[model samples]
Every structure is written in structure tokens, then in C-alpha cells.
Target: MKAVTIRTFGGPEGLAVIDVPVPAPAAGQVLIRNEAIGVGGVDAVIRRGTLAMYGFEEGHIPGSEVAGTVTAVGDGVDASWVGRRVWAFTGVGGGYVEHAIAAVEEVFPLPADLSAVDAVTLGSSGMVAHFGLAHAHFAPGESVLVRGAGGSLGIMTVQLAAHGGAGAVAVTTSSAERGDRLRKLGATHVLDRSGQGGGADAPAGYDVIIDIIAGADMPSFFAKLNPNGRMVAVGAVGGRPPADFGMAMMAAFQKSMSFATFSAATVSEPDRRAVRTAQFDAASRGELRTVVHELLPLEQAALAHRKMDAGEVFGRIVLTP
Candidate 1:
């Protein structure tokens, strides 16, 4: 079996393509022959060593999202899934290989109409978006503001919020190109963070704010929420441990709003199953569209990591084995 493994924590160059024996499934696990793999920003963070202290043992495979066919089923597992097409969240690793093993419970059958490319990209990002939107408790006619609306998760957030009956959906992107994409993805209003006029004169209140980039802009995002509104923090791509929270509290107090952060690991099993089912249903109906920015072979995984780290691509990038 061929796989990309990080022998050392450094850059994309650190990921070496090597031939290794195919892994056999353990008890209650299934071995899959991977067809497609999702490349995420966190993979880049791990490669760049920003997240190195988290302690991923050497020779680790960095992908969490995978879509493939089960080739072997382990003890105590149903054999019916052997030929089934599935997509799964492997948590932190084991998706960047020709053959990978996953616990049977973590796998979900993919819709017949959806392709491997789309299903692989849905991975954690789509699930997280579904979780965040549900947490926002969006009611009919409520409004939402999504920061980083150009990224893969941001695009899903925009579509889900609009589909859930949001009265107004506002999205912010630092790239002008992404502004156009966000509007097409159901954003009622698009703000370009790079321009002074984009978000500067925008409305000051929204019922919900889904912030993916939560660093220097925390204060500004807090100010945009309406009284009693909820803000769900999903990512800190810009930076972490944001400066003073006094101003945010004052703003929140004025509006009686609440702020919360989500880690995918904290989501319950039932919720995870619900999210996967809902997302696949949406995909089958053509309601959920995955924007694939690039697709590369498994050997080119390092290049994919570079592109994601440079922030030059939008939507999801998938790797085929």
C-alpha cells in the first residue's frame, strides 16, 4: 500500500510518499480502499508545526476525511458493509493512504447519486457546519453573518443558513473573487474584508454570527450581533487567545447575546449521525453542492498541502489514490 506520512514536523516537504504494508482491520474496525481524501487547513497547521505540540506520533497520516469502499471487515462487524461505499471522519489521521481502517460506527453509507469526490470533501467541515447552524437555533426570518464565507466550511454555513430560512444571510471574504462566489451560494449580502467600504458601513445587527476567523476581528464581529443574538466560533485561522474580552462583554451585555465555541470532538454520536444523514440527503437532492477547487493524485499530496497553507484555493481540495 502507498501512503503519505509525516516523518518529521516541518513543512509540506516533510510529508514523504512511501510504500508500506496494507493494514488489517482490528476488532470492530473495517479496512477501506480509499478512493478520495479531503485536504484541510488543519493538515497544513500540523505540517507547519504550529500544532506539533499536540503530539501526533511520527509516521502519522494527517487526513481526517475519507471516502472509499470497504474491502475487509474485522471481527464482530457485519459483512454486508464490505462492498458498500462510505464516507467517514477518522478523527485525526488515517485518510491519506491506499488502504485505511476505521471503526465501523464512524462510517456512513454514501448516497448513490453522490460521487466520491463530493463525499470525501464533506468530511468534518460539512458536519461542523451543520452542527454550528443547528446550535445557532436559526428560526424562520432570522438573520446570520458568516465570517470566512469563502472557505469550504463557510460556503456550507452560508447555504445551510439560507436553506434553514434565514431572512438575511451576510458573508465576509477577504478575497474579491470569493465575494462573488459567496453571493452565488445564497448570501444576501457579501462583504469583502480587504476593502474599507465593504463591512465598514454594513448593518450593525444580526440575529446570529458564525465566525471562523476569530482573532483580531473578534470585537468587530461581536459588535455586529443583535441583542440576544448567538455567536458560534468554529475556527481561529487568523490567530488565537484574542485580545481583551471586556469590549465583547459590553457589546454582548448590551444585546443580551451569548458566545460559544465548538470542537468537533465534543459533538455527540447521535448528532454526528444526524448531521451525516442530513448532509447526504441534501447532496442527493442537489441542495448541497461541494465546490472542489482542486483534485490531485495521492502522490501529489504535498503540493495540495502547500496550496491549502498558502490560502490560494477556495472550497475543498480532494486527493485521489
Candidate 2:
């Protein structure tokens, strides 16, 4: 099988496509002939060797999610899974290939009407947005602000919050055109990437903040929360915040505001599967939106990463094999 692997660390130039042995499914796993693979921020992080401390090395495949047909199953997996269309979580690698392996528990059956690109787009990101809201104890009437709202995860947060009956759904994005596009997707207000309104005054404060960019500016967003507001940090694509970023919460002790980081990794397998299934169903039924920026051939994996690095991608980029 052919797979794209990181031959070295740093630039996307290091990504190379090469032939490799087809991996066999182990016990409780299934082999998928991948049709669509999701390219995410985590992939770029891995390619840059940012995860070196955690044992991510050169020659690693950097995709975490894929959607395709099951070719075979290992011991303990049901035979019925063969030839079934499904979405699978490939953990941190192995998904950027013609064939990928995933534990049976990580696979979910796709709706008949759902396309492979849509399946991969909403598979893992939808889980994060759904659980992140729950983690923050979000209430339907509360206002929401999704920071870094251009990518798949942020885009999911915006629509989910609006569909969940949020009073106001605000987003921070790069361009006015993109903001207008997001408005059609349920965003009530759009702020620039700096989290500031163009001319109109920003909302008094947000009741809940879904922050994907948690860097030095994190403290500023922390201050925008209303009383008893909760802020959930789901990604830190902008780099880490200051060492004393938490001090702002303490400084405004009377507000009862809170801050915490969240990841879908903390959720139980059953819970993750259930939520992902629901999201896929919702999308298939047209109750939820799945934004796919583009579908590229698997060999263009490096080009996909380059677009992500340049902030040119507006939504999920799917690679077809």
C-alpha cells in the first residue's frame, strides 16, 4: 500500500509518499480501504516534530481519522463489518494511506446518504465540539463565542451552539467574506481574528467561550466572559499562553468565571462513538452542516498541509485515496 510519511521534521517539504507493506488487522481491529482522510492541525503539529516529547518520530503517518469501507476484520470483530461503509478513528497515524487499521470500537457505521468526505470531516471534530460544550456546562440560552472559527472544529462549534438554541453565536475569523459565509451557517456576529468587532461594539460579554487559539491573547478573551461564565480551551494552535494566564480568573474572583482545557481523548469510547454517530446522522439528515474545503488526491497530502500552514483552508480538507 501507498502512504505519506514524514521523512524529516519541519516544513511540509519533508512529507513524502512511499510504498509500504499492507498492515494486517490485529485482534479486535479492522482494516479499512480508506476513501477519505481528514487533515487536521494535529497532523501539522506532528509534521513539525512538536510532539517529539511524546514519541512522534520521522517516518510517522500523521492522520487521525478516515472514512471508508471495511475490507476485513480481526478476531473478535463481527464478520458483518466487511464491506460496510464506516468512519474510523486511526488515533494519531496510519490514516494517510490506501489501507488503514482501526480498533473495532473506534469504527462507526455511516449513514447510507453520507459521503466519505462528510464522514471524515465530522467524525472527530464533532465529538470535540459536542463534548466541549458539555464540559463547559453550557446552557441553551447562554451566549457563545467560538475563537478561531475558520477550521473544522471551530465551524462545528458555531453551528452546534446555534442549533442548540444559544442566544447569540459569535465567531472570530479572518476575513469579512468568510464571516458572511459563517453567518449563513448560524453565526449571529463575527469578530476579526483578534476577537474584536470591526465597528460595532462587541457583545457585553459572552456566557461561554470556545477557544481554539490559546496563546498570549487568551487572558484577554478570559476577561470577556460574563459572570459565572466558563471558557473551554480545546486547541492551542496559536501557541501556549503565558505562565500566569490563570491569574486573570483569580483576579476577577467575584465573577465566578472558570477556565479549563478539554480533549475528546478524555471521553469514554462508547460515549465518543455515540456522539459521533449522532453527528453523522444529523449531517446526513441535513440537520447539521459539514463544511469540506476541498478534496485532494492522497498524494497531495503535503500540499494540504501547506495550505493549512498558510491559513488558506476555511474548513476540513479531505484527501481521497
Candidate 3:
């Protein structure tokens, strides 16, 4: 089997594809003949050694989600699972190869109509977006704003909130071209984010704000929330927000506004499963669309990482082995 590994993590150049032995499924696990791999922002963070506590090694595979067919099942797994097409959360960072292993509890069978590309693309980002909408305290007919709306999670947030009955959906993107696409996806308003400084006025007073860019944009975004409105900061892609981020909240004290951050990384198993199931159901019904920016071969993991790090990928990047 071939897998992508990062021994000395720093840049995309260090993401190396190498031959490795196929891993066998242990108890409660299934072996997948992986057809597609989901590349996400967290994968990039792990690759950069920013979260070095994860203890990635020379042969550490760097993917988390995969869509594939089950070739075999380990002890305690149902024999009927073999040959079933499914999308799963790999136990470790081992989803980057031709074959992957996942715990049975982490696997979800995919409908025949779902392509592996779509399945992988809908993995983690979709889950986060689904849950973040709740953290926004979303309500039907309310105005919503999705910051960093060009990214995978942000894009889904825009779609879900739009479809969930938001009266007006707004999005912030780096280009007018990107904003135009977002408008087609359901955004009623598109704000050009390129060269737009933090705290820039962006048509204020949204009822719910989904912020994935929590750096310089925090203050302005925090101040724009309507009275009793909620802002959910899901990512810090631009960089960490300033330490005194509460200043905006203090100023908005009269509004009774609230700000919270969510990460699927810290979610419990049951909660993760519930959100993923809801996302899959929405995808199956065509209510939620999974967008794929690019599909590359497994060996091009480095290129995928580079594009992701540069914020050039508009949607999820799938890797085929």
C-alpha cells in the first residue's frame, strides 16, 4: 500500500508518499479498500507540526476521513459489512493509503447514489457546519452572515443556514467572483473580503454570525451582532484573535450579545455521530450539497496541502488512491 507521511513537518514539500504494509483491522474494526480521501484544514495543521502533541511519526498517515468499500472485517464486526460502500473516520491518521482501517462505530454506510468524492467531501467540514449552525442560535427568517464563506465549512454553513429558512443570508469572500458563486448558492448578500481590513463595516446587525476568520475580523464581527444575536467562531484561519477579544463584547454589553467557539475536534462520540447522521441525511435528500474544489491522486497530497494552506481551495479536496 502507498500512503502519505510527514516525518519532519514544516511545509508541503515534506509531505511524502511512500510504500507501506497494508494494515489489518483489529477487533470492532473494518478494512476499507479506500476509494477517496478527505483532506481538511486540521490535516494541514497536523502536517505543519502546529499540533505536534499529536505525535505524528515518519510513517504517520495524515488523513482522517475516507469513503470506500469494505474488503474485510475484524473480529466482533458483522460479516455482512464486507463489500459495503461506506464513509468512515479512520482510527488514527491512517486514511491516506489505498487501504484504511476504521472502527465500526465510526463508519457510516453510504447510499449507492453518493459518489466517493461527495462522501469524502462531506466528512468533517459538513459535521462542523451542521453543529456550528446550532451554536449560532439560528432562527427561521433571521438574517445570517457567514464569514470566510469560500472555505469548505463556511460554504456549507452558508448553504445550510440559507436552506434552513434564514430570511437573508450574507457571505464574505476574498473576491467578487467567489461572492457571485456564493450568491448562486443562496446568499442574498455578498461582501468582497479582499484587502478588507478587520472591523470593516459589512452591512451590520445580522441575527446570527458564523465566523471562521477570527483574527482581525473579530471586533467588527462581534459588534455587528443584533441584540441577543449569537456569533459562533468556528475557526481561526487568518490567525488567532487578539487576546482582549472581549472588548467588543464589553462594548456590545447593552445588546446582550453572545460569542462562542465550536470545534468538532472536542465533540463527544454520540454528538459527533448525531451531527454526521443529520448531515448525511441532508446530503442524501439533496438539501445539502457537498462541493469539491479538486480531486487529486494520493501522491499529490503535498500539492493539496499547499493549496489548502494558501487558502486557494474553495471546497473540499478529495484524494483518490
What are the per-residue Cα lDDT tens digits for candidate 3 across 75-175? 99999999899999985588899999999999998877878888888877788887888777798999888888987888888888888899888888877
lDDT by residue for model 1 (1-321), tens: 899998788778899999989998889999888899988877766666666668876688889888889999999999999999999777688788988889898999998998888987676778888888777777878988898777788888898888888988888876767888888888877776621234554556789888887767676677777888888888776656456854676745767888888788888888899888888878888988889999999999999988866777789889999
Taking the tens digit of each residue's C-alpha lDDT, what string does model 2 give over 1-321? 899999999999999999999998999999999999999988988899877898999999889999999999999999999999999999879899999999999999999999999998988888899999999999998999999999999989998999899999999999999999899888999998878883465587999999988878999887889999999999987768999998989999999999999988899988887788888889999988989999999999999999999999998999999
Best by TM-score: 2
Question: lDDT for every model?
Answer: 0.82, 0.91, 0.83
Report clash pairs, candidate 2: none
Model 1 misplaced regions, further than 4 Å? 194-202, 243-247, 250-252
Error of 2 at 208 (Å): 0.6
**Order the candidates by lDDT, highest first — what do you get?**
2, 3, 1
Error of 2 at 75 (Å): 1.3
Model 1 has an lDDT value of 0.82
Pick by lDDT: 1 or 2, better one: 2
Model 3 accuracy (lDDT, Cα): 0.83
Each prediction's TM-score against the native? 0.92, 0.97, 0.91
- Model 2 clash tally, residue pairs: 0
